[model samples]
Target: MTTIAVVGGGISGLVAAYRLRTRLGPDARIVVLEESGRFGGKLRTVPIADGPVDVGAEAFIARRPEVPALLAELGLTDQVENPSSARPLIWAGGRLHPLPAGTLMGIPATSGSLAGLVDVDTVARIDAEPSVPLHWDRGADVSVAALVGSRFGEQVVRRSVDPLLGGVYSGLADTASVRATVPALAAALDAGATSLTEAVGRALPPPSDAPVFGTLRGGYGVLLDALAAASGAEFHAHTAGASLRRSGCRWEVDPVGEVDGVIVAVPADRAATLLAEAVPAAATQAGRIPLASSVVVALALPKEAALPDNSGILVATGEDLAAKAFTLSARKWPHLGAREVTLARASFGRFGDAAIVDADDDQLITLARADLATVSGVTDQPVAAVVQRWHGGLPQYRAGHLEIVAELEAAIAGVDGLEVAGAMLHGVGVPACVQSATTAATRLLATVAG
Candidate 1:
């Protein structure tokens, strides 16, 4: 039997073990090590007085194939639910406005697409006559905010991108890397888009039957529980890896004990310590990728309450409130609700914005209540509230992030029977983690077989 140790019980590690079990037969003994007491690192489903809530990743994108397909493999397809039909509102221009059609991720390719959301002056600036030219050469990495403001105009960032992406990444659009965060749009611009009005006319995929978002019936935890069952790997909770080193031919995983064939998948900061002793170069490079903290506050309101249908709202920079972003938890997936339970969630924490992360549970709820009351127009107080703090949650993919990842990948290649995988390694979302895991697992298994 081939023996392998999978570190970090997050989506990637568990998926790696599960895929390995399916591919190499059940004879192979797969051992998974998790630093925390819980198996699913980020995929957590918290319970409310009436219904369940998702404090971590609220939903997965349907356009991204990996997670949805993976869920089906775990027999979770029947459980998948799409976002509600009602439109989502962005808190901008001092009030909520219905997001216009044909604008994806807040980037409006057409001037007319700004209707209902943006003012006329902003719309006229998007016209091709006075379009400004960006000097970014091919393959040059820049900020997503810069690309949108320079090519699409500043209102595009404030009106669309700010509310849409700000809700997810929790950072200024310009600060987030164009290549790392939204590469497809960046590619279109790099292909010689003088302006968004010009670029959008080129024609892309007409929206598909699949909605923008999806969630498991039982919250993200359904997929986590399935991964636990499918991956026949030995499990350890609350065991933090001290340091890692390479022996003569085999690698030594010293998490207060010696083990072989270690896969370090913790956050970049935590991974830095293990990789430093095992592969010094990787440690040095990993440390350069900084991680920030975030907080999510789950609120369940009365079903009779008047609010937007099921879609949640995202906040812009320089907002009156401290929340990073939020969602209508029950609206995305009906499985989240009970007889009269109406669950909602909002996040706090962004670069240069740390209001809710440092606050206690009581203070956190107070901030959320005020924000929700103003934005959602709900007068009723929350029936239930839960605050979750994730230390080192946000991965900063600063400029030249890919170059650093390349350097980190190269350093680990020198070590025998060792590999790394996580959000920081590749893309930061669920799909990226799954894709990175598939790549690393194939390489590690092949190395062992050779």
Candidate 2:
């Protein structure tokens, strides 16, 4: 029988083990070691009202086939639910402005459409972007702030793009790689499109009435629980694998027994420590990947709080608040609304901003409440509240991130029976992690078959 060790119990690690079982059959013995006591690293659900609410990742981009397909495979397709409200408002210039239609990651297809969100001068600068000659090719990659700010203006990046991108990456636009974050815009620029407007229009997928994102009717925890139950891998919670070494043909997990193969699925920092002896180059590179800390506060309000009708509000930089974004949970998801209770969530801590995340749970909730009240004018005390702090939660993809990832992968390839998979290595969302894990599992299976 072939035995494999997976060093992490997050969704990515679990998915890899599950895939390995399906491919290698019952003869394979899979062991999953999680450093933490609980599973679902970022897919947590907190009890609120009559049901549970996702306090971590609330939804996944449905356009990505991996998550939906996985859900279908797990017999969870019937519970897939779309957001009741898709529109999001951006807080800027002392008021809330609806994120304009026809924008890709807040890069407007038509700059004129952004008039409501930014100042007149910014709009004028954007209008002149078409006259600026195209200088980049498809192969070129640059920071989102550099490309969009140079073409449109700094105000556009600070006011519009930064908040939207920040909500996703927990990182600033000036440092994030455009190619890695918004590939469609990068591809358009790389194609040598003369105008940003035309490039976006050409690059964006055709309009669709289908929901852009989907989540389980109950919570993501439902799907995660199902996956964990189906995996059949021996789970060792709170067992952190310390190092890796090779034992002739098999791989050895330090302080633990040996396995035929090993998957290092923890965060980059932890993975680096484990792989340092076996794959020094990859370990060094992984250690250098930046990570960000974040906090989320979930508030259950009285039914009459009168929250904003939009899905959420993304806070623009320079806003006099600690919060980076706010999601009116009950308004956004109809299922939450069905409970006859108002729900809201506030997010804090950006890539370079970590101090706020260190606050105690009470302080964090107070901050969230203050911001929520300021933006939505709902000052009533919450019926219940939950605070979740994630240290080194999000991985930052700096400019040249793709190149860095390629080098890391190449370095790991030299080590037989060793594979690395996680959000830190690829995209950040649930679907992206699933895709990365699936690829890693396939590669490992190929080695066995060979």
- The most accurate candidate by lDDT is 2
Give the candidate number with the greatest TM-score: 2
For model 2, residues 146-262, the per-residue Cα lDDT tens digits are 888888888788888899888888888986898888888777766767788768877888988889988888898888788788888888998999778989988878656888888
TM-score of each: 0.93, 0.97
lDDT of each: 0.75, 0.86
| Candidate 2 worst ten-residue window by lDDT | 132-141
Judge candidate 1 against the unseen true structure and give its global Cα lDDT, from 0 to 1. 0.75
Candidate 2 regions off by >4 Å? 137-139
